[model samples]
Target: MDTKSLIIEKATILFQQKGYKSVGLTEILKACNVTKGALYHHFPNGKEQLLIACLQVLNEVIMTDIESIFRRHLSTKEALLSIIDKLIRDLETEGTITGYTFSSIVSEMATVSEPVRHACSALYENIQQIYSAKLVTDGLSNESASAIALLMTASIEGAMMLCLTQQSSDPLKTIAKLLPKLLKDI
Candidate 1:
């Protein structure tokens, strides 16, 4: 990765774990093995700008993965199960849920910055749309698909938080089991 990309990547991981307020430019610099000058070169506005960059990176990665899962699975239920399973695996392996960045950042900086709040909202909206589109393709009406998609997104995020706090994947596993049942009427 280039220096800027490296900084974003390292910062994303650290911010996901440590929250925006907790991580300093020094920590990000050390993580990326870059000097302050290099970081400032890419993110002239400093930490907030760098954070916004990190949100963009998170959006691309998370959306691409979700889109890919939907493409690969013919069944919407299976696709959703796959997503939940992936979440469980991610939590177990990396301690990250889909919106892990949002969870960490919102607590600290979201209230203070419009850009950060906007980016986080956009990420969630985009994720919901991805799920809604997949459901529509699977033969649900736009209204129902969108509604269910919202439910899925909320439940998954909630479950992810539970998984994080409880240090167990049970909540996500439960979502994996129960969410698909919501699709049965289709």
Candidate 2:
């Protein structure tokens, strides 16, 4: 990667592992193996700007993955369950689950950083929009689809949080197994 991309890439991982407020620029610089001048050259405004960039990168990656997941499954319910199952599998294979990027940063920086909060919100809105679109394709009305997407988002995030806190993948696995039954009425 180029210098600017390298800076953003390293900063993204740092922000993901540690919250926006907890990671210092010095640590980012050291992690990137670049100097302060290089960082400032890439991010003129500094850590907050870098944090925003990291959020944007994560937002792109996550939304793109969600869109792909939706495209792969013809049934909206199957698509949603497949996503939950993937979360469970990922937790098992990786042996750890960090909370979602938007949740982690928003919890830490929402009150302090308007731009960061907006970026986080936009990321979630985009994901929900994708889910709603897929549900519409599955024959649900727009309003109901949107509401159901919101519930799925909350449930998935909560399951991830449980997995991370409990240090076990059982919570996610259980959610995956039970989600189809929960969605049967919808």
Candidate 3:
């Protein structure tokens, strides 16, 4: 990776593990093994700028995964259940999930930083949009698809948190079971 990409990659992992507020630029610099000048040379706005880049990459990676899952399955229900099952498996093996750094970052620094708030909101909106599109493809109306996608977004993220906190993947596993049942009607 180039210097700029290296900085962003390191910052992204730190933000995902430690959250936005908990991580400092010094730590990011150390993680990247780059000096403040090098970091600032790429991100003049410093930590917040690096954070926005991370969020952008996060959104891209997450949407790609979701789109791929939706494409692989014939029904929205199957895709969703598969998605949740993957999350459950990841949590069970790794004890933490990837492509979900925004949950903590948004809750941590949304009020304190406008860029952070905007980036996080964009990621969330994109997630819902992808889910809604998949539901629509599965024969639901736009209105119903949008509503159901919103519910799935909120529930899945919340369940991920519960899984993390409870140190059990039960919440996501429960979601995996329940979401398919709910989507069966749609």
Q: lDDT by residue for model 3 over 109-158, one digit each (tens)?
A: 89999888998899889989989998998899999999999999999999
For model 2, the run of ten residues with the poorest summed lDDT: 95-104
- Model 2 residue pairs with clashes: none
RMSD of 3: 1.1
Quality of model 3 by C-alpha lDDT:
0.87
- State the RMSD for candidate 2: 1.7
TM-score of 2: 0.92
Number of the top candidate by TM-score? 3
Model 3 ranges with Cα > 4 A deviation: none
**Candidate 2: tens digits of C-alpha lDDT, residues 1-186:** 898888888888777677788899899889889999999998899998888888888888888888889899987778887787777777788765443435777889888989988988888899899988987887889999899889878778787877877878787777777766756755
- Root-mean-square deviation (CA) per prediction: 1.6, 1.7, 1.1
What is the C-alpha lDDT profile of model 1 across 1-186, one tens digit per residue? 688889998998888888888999999999888999999999999999999999998999889988999999987898889988888887888766644436768767778999999998899899999999988988999999999999999998888878888889999898888888899876
Which is the better candidate, 2 or 3, if ranked by lDDT?
A: 3
Clashes of 3: 0
